[model samples]
Target: MSCIGNCIDHACIKSFHSMIKRELVYLEKFKTREQAIRRIFEYIEVWYNRERIHSSKGIMSEYENL
Candidate 1:
């Protein structure tokens, strides 16, 4: 097996965190852990993957980019 593969995964995660912070975390005021979890789930499943237009993919959502 090869030792090196997709070292950018860490970077990808960091970038995702940065984006989530900018787009949702910093904008919303959640009162509880439950609310935060629910909102984060919706942001990922509904907005980020399905609705948000990824610049690299040009008009296509992250799901489409996959």
Candidate 2:
């Protein structure tokens, strides 16, 4: 069985962090905390949820699951 810890059972969250770092965070520069927040919000709500395809979901976005 998988052990439960901060990240031991949260592989998807870790994958998300890695993906965001690779695909969004590393490519952008924010001058303020608000800007970063807004951009990350947009990335998750607008891009990641509605637009980007997930391999695990087999060509559909998370939005389609709802």
Candidate 3:
């Protein structure tokens, strides 16, 4: 595993954090920790992987790119 701030082999980690911050963290509030966890899971597994378009990957979702 790579440390946070170390992007040598973890550009994907930084990119994932940036996407989560931009699309979810800065945009919503949760009443409970479980809610936040669930939403984050859904955001990453469903929306980000399946739906969101990434410009760096030619407007394709990670799943699509793969």
Candidate 4:
């Protein structure tokens, strides 16, 4: 359980920080909080986990090999 928690924490924080820096934080204008939340959710669920290729996953998204 502790190992799982640690892994989850690391993945969540690292992904969140990267996404914020890549999108919202680097954007010129501030979007509404709701829009930000929706976009983040879409990026994580639709793109990062499903569509985007990850080198750590041998260049495939989690959904592809799973």
Say which candidate scores most in lDDT.
1
- Which regions of candidate 1 are displaced past 4 Å? 1-7, 51-66
TM-score of 3: 0.62
Which residue runs of candidate 4 sit more than 4 Å off their true CA positions?
1-12, 23-25, 28-30, 51-66
Candidate 2 yields a Cα-based lDDT of 0.83
Model 4: per-residue lDDT, tens digit, 1-66?
A: 356647765876798788767865577354697876787777667766674446566685556679
Work out the TM-score per prediction. Answer: 0.64, 0.66, 0.62, 0.43
RMSD of each: 5.5, 4.6, 6.1, 5.4
Better of 1 and 2 by lDDT: 1
lDDT of 3 by residue, 1-66 (tens): 677766587777888899899989889989999999999999888887674446555675556568
Cα shift from native, residue 56, model 1 (Å): 14
Error of 3 at 40 (Å): 0.5
Cα lDDT of candidate 4 equals 0.67
Better of 2 and 4 by lDDT: 2
Over 4 Å off, model 3: 1-6, 51-66
Clash count, one per candidate? 0, 0, 0, 0
Q: Extract clashing residue pairs from model 1.
A: none
Clash count in backbone of candidate 3: 0
Q: lDDT per residue, candidate 1, 12-59, as tens digits?
A: 789999999999999999999999999999999988777444555577
